[model samples]
Target: MSLVKAGQLDYLNELFSRYSKRIYNYFLKSTLERAESDDLTQELFIRVMKYRNSYKEGHSVQFWIFQIARNMIKDHFRKMKIHKDQFNLVEVIPEREDVGDDELFEREKKLHRAMKELSDEKRELLVLSKFQGMKYEQIAKMRDTTVSNIKVQVHRTIKELKEAYFQLEEV
Candidate 1:
């Protein structure tokens, strides 16, 4: 990143190689639209280049990149005049080897539905903390909140998810 910041355009390739899949996966998880996620991932790298000079010191590059990705998604939604709740119906479930198990598959589908029903903020937190495997401290820094606050929010979010999941089970 420093190399790219220093105007070495070739170094951008290195950054792309390192981050493209991760960024794409982030979009894929959030959007669940393969083509849209691909486009967003490409656009994110373009924005990084366009805003290369704005990259500051002492911040995690991953966090900075993700913040930009978040902004891009928000802008996209705004431009389309779509409410997040209507569009956020897709959630990615990890593929299981036992694909023949009807019960497990049904449960996974229910969980995905419950995840989609969560508020966008809670879903984003879960994506960053759980799926992305980022630490609470890192998420707090990215979100401009205290670690304790992030922890509390994550706990509450999990509880809500559990309740939602159970309600689905009952139905």
Candidate 2:
């Protein structure tokens, strides 16, 4: 990061090589669209280079990069003018290796539906924290909030998700 910020253009390639997969996976999880994810991932690195001068010392590069990613996703949705209802919500469902297990497949489907019922904010929080395995502190840094606030939000979001899941189960 420092190297990139210092006008070392070569460092951008190294950084891209190291973080491209992680960034692509994050977008893939969020959008569930491979082509869009790939495009956004490439755009992110471009923005990284374009705005390299904005990089500051003492900041976590992971958080900084993902903050850009989150913004890019928001921009994508805004440009597409797609409502949450129009999103491919089922794409969030993980593919099952045991495709023959009807029960498990049904459960996964139900979970995906329940997750789609969540507010975008709550859903993104869960995706970053639970799915991406980011620490609360790191998430807080990305959001410019305190860790305790993030923890509370994560707890509340999980509780709401469980309620949604059970409601779907009952149906």
Candidate 3:
């Protein structure tokens, strides 16, 4: 980031190579839309380059990058809300050779359904803390909250998720 800020644009390639997949997956899991994830991931790096000078010195590059991603995601959801009538909620899961277990597939479907029932804030927290494997501290920092509060929120969200999952399983 510093290098990019210093006018060495070539260094952006290095940063992209390291962070793109993780950023792509983060967007994918958070949005559950492959096409949008691709666009958002591409746009995120562009923003990084465009706003390279805004990065704080000595701060975690990953954190700063994700801050941009988070804002993009929020914007995406806002747009999605405005276009909700045109958006298809149905998703066709792509079969993969690696995922041969029918049980696992069904569980994944139920999990996604359960997640959809959660509030947007709760779902984002769960995705960040659990699916994305982000630490509570980092998430707290990102949300401008305390670590303990984030932990408790994550815990309650998990409990709510479990209840939702079990209910879906029962159905």
Candidate 4:
């Protein structure tokens, strides 16, 4: 990133190659739209270049990139006037479970449905922590909150997810 920030345009390739797919997956999970995710991913890199001067030295590059991604997602939802309850979290189960394929698929479906029931804020937190594999400390800094607060919120969110999951089972 410093290399890119130093007006060496060629180094942008390294940054793109390193972060593109992970950032793209973040967009995909947040928006749940493949085409939009692609467009957003491309746009994000453009912004990074356009705002390369804003990159602070000695900071985590990953954090800076995700801060941009998070802002873009907020802008997207803002422009669309998207309601919190309307978003759907499509997949929640891991692949390659020891359980039979049919059983795994069923579990995935139920979890997916339960995830959709989460508010957008809760869903985004879960996606960042669980799906994107971002550490709680990173998420805390990203959200401008304390790590303990993020952990408590995550714990409550998990509890909510489990409750929702079991309710689906009873249905």
lDDT accuracy of residue 54 in candidate 1: 91
lDDT (10s digit) by residue, model 4, range 64-156: 999999999888768545564554334534464644588777877787788777766787788899988999999999999999999999999
Our model 2 lands, by Cα RMSD against the true structure, at 3.5
- Winning model by lDDT: 3
Winner by TM-score: 3
TM-score of each: 0.78, 0.74, 0.87, 0.81
Clashing pairs in 3: none
Q: What is the C-alpha lDDT of each candidate?
A: 0.80, 0.81, 0.85, 0.84
**Stretches of model 2 off by over 4 angstroms after superposition:** 77-87, 93-110, 168-171
- Superior by lDDT: candidate 1 or candidate 2: 2
Evaluation by lDDT, superior candidate among 1 and 4? 4
As for lDDT, the candidate ahead, 1 or 3, is 3
Tens digits of lDDT, candidate 1, 96-145: 66546878887877877887777656776787788788899888887789
Error of 3 at 7 (Å): 1.9
Question: Candidate 3 lDDT, tens digit per residue, 6-90?
Answer: 9999999999999998898787767777888889999999999999999999999999999999999999889888887765544
- Write down the lDDT that model 3 would get: 0.85
lDDT per residue for candidate 2 within 53-163, as digits (tens), equals 887898878778999999998787675456645545435455676445879888877766787777666777888998789999888978889999999999999999899
**TM-score result, candidate 3:** 0.87
